[model samples]
Target: MDYKTYKTDDFLFDESFRQWTAGTSPEATAFWEQWLTQNPDRVHVVRQAQELVRALNDHYQDDATDARLTSELRRLVRNAAERREAEAADTPSIPLGQRISPWRWASVAAVIILLGFGLWRYGNVNRRVAAESYTHLTKTAQVSLQETVNTSDHVVNILLSDGSAVTLRPKSRLSYPAQFKATTRVVYLDGEAFFDVVKNPAKPFLIYANQTVTKVLGTTFLVRAFESEKNVIVTVRTGRVSVYTQQDFEKAQQSGLRRIQGVILTPNQQMIYNLGDHQLMKALVEKPAAIMPETVSREQVFEDAPVGKVFATIEQTYGVKLLYNDDDLSACLVNLTFTNESLLERLDVVCQTIGASYEVLDGQIVINSKGCK
Candidate 1:
């Protein structure tokens, strides 16, 4: 609504509005907060501008930067408001309360602070904030794609139009929509990334990386699929994720994927697809941890309990499949207490007590031991 009236710089420099949005001034915050509530149409604009300011503040934490920006923003907002008033002199002035609604001064503080800085710099936050201007400028209704290439050595954070956040690893390339398609949120990656997706059940979030197609709904996960690497791996940090071959998903469109074609991974689980053989292997992550409920005490101790029961508890806590033969280890009893040690550490202790060892095979733990006589 009349976005052309204020340039990007105007929003960034407006000190009065920035104070409200930043909650630095209580009086200003209250007035602007109420004003924004009444102006739903302007919410997106305000949010974008706010994101820009936050990005700058995060990058440049100097007090001088804020002062210079505040001065520039003040000048811009004042000049623009004056010009608007002069143009509308003939019209009756709106009440002070009503004036704030039409032009939410609160969100009018974003501008081109990053004029040449670069794109989405928020640290690995999948904001999924609406970039209306970027999306609106596209000519065709076809997929409006935007590529974020992290040529630098450090990780680059990017925000998608659908509000999803992508943390692109160094030397990685990610192509995503400026605005999502109505049915699915799709992104293509050539290297590695950590994604925190915004959930929309109607539209699934899909990542097409290397030879894999990962599907999720509002989850955080990591995908590593370098061009030179032999395997494309998808690891779940939180929430469930489905991994399948791009070829398989495309082929199974008519009748849906066969049960064996895809793998669903829960937290601390990983799905690896070999590029050469196209074989998918599911397993636990390298450093597994106990995923107990909040109510369960983390410092549970075992006294005179069978070692099998201890291993079983580990399996259930971390959602891992411990492959020790129950029959072989049924006689191994142990008395130990597990406190804050990680799952791996706990396992080491248990195995030492029973004089056995373990190895991981395809995400399952295989125990090697003669029966503890």
Candidate 2:
């Protein structure tokens, strides 16, 4: 079978894929792992299908639920074949026992486990489901949306109606409206994407990803919320953005609250939302780029400059706040040359010179020392 065109639903129904997910057939496992290695773009779809298979397997642990779903699946298959036969005969067919549910072809177990009430019944089975699943978000959105899937190896650019641009990475997908609502421009993302939002203070731009909602007026940021990953990361490149838990966003909407509550990230900062414990952590990006390099002195040399002055320059250049005892650090002096060194590297030199240590706390660098003579 040409698995390239197969979607999540198709993979969920494929016996070989199911076997590979269940680890029942060694041949299936070898084939799928090698296939995934060769076709890396399908990793997202394969992961989703694997999760569905595991969910069904978990549900089947309950014998009663298993029997019911098994019976339902057989019945649905029979009805589908009968309907096909009826169509071939050119006869008006009877209703196929209540129009085939949207996902009947995949697995009845999926419907049983993913339904609203079903989720409540299954202890924590729904935890495996990613918050950014295309079907999940689109169905719950209650608005018309157009979905763009990036199947190629290269990044795909999507221009939203709101003049925003999204750089969708390979194997990722974006669902957005042809035209945004008057109040807000909302988009749903399932994988990795970089968003360059246009400034519109009136209508905020919101991105719904795994367990997190990123709100921006106008900024450039990258969001990584892949299903296989445990954390949802929002890294800001320019401007500012507010990151909120998906639960908080819904609560604010229902309460008609106008205030935005969440972690506010500026340039060179990032927010990591852990899906397991639902913790939101703010930290600096791996490589901190100078935000205002042009404003710094052209000489790029500091001679006998007060430590506070050096820290001020560093803060101004990187746009990151540094915490230190003003009096303790003010007595220190530093002789340093700043060329293209990173923010942390500069901090290291300054800290070493003053016999102080620096640690990152809540996205801010804090200098630790008793007093610098």
The true-versus-predicted C-alpha distance at residue 92 of model 2, in Å, is 62
Specify the highest-TM-score model's number: 2
Report the Cα lDDT for residue 367, model 1. Answer: 83
**Candidate 2 pairs with clashing backbones:** none
RMSD for each model, in Å, please?
20.3, 16.4
lDDT of 2: 0.80
Q: Count the backbone clashes (under 3 Å) in each candidate.
A: 14, 0
Runs with alpha carbons beyond 4 Å of true place in candidate 1 = 1-142, 161-163, 254-260, 289-300, 306-309, 323-333, 354-357, 366-373
Model 1, 49-119: lDDT tens digits are 77776766655442236665566446655665775577669668778766655434434323323532323
Q: lDDT per model, in order? A: 0.73, 0.80
Determine the backbone clash count of candidate 1. Answer: 14
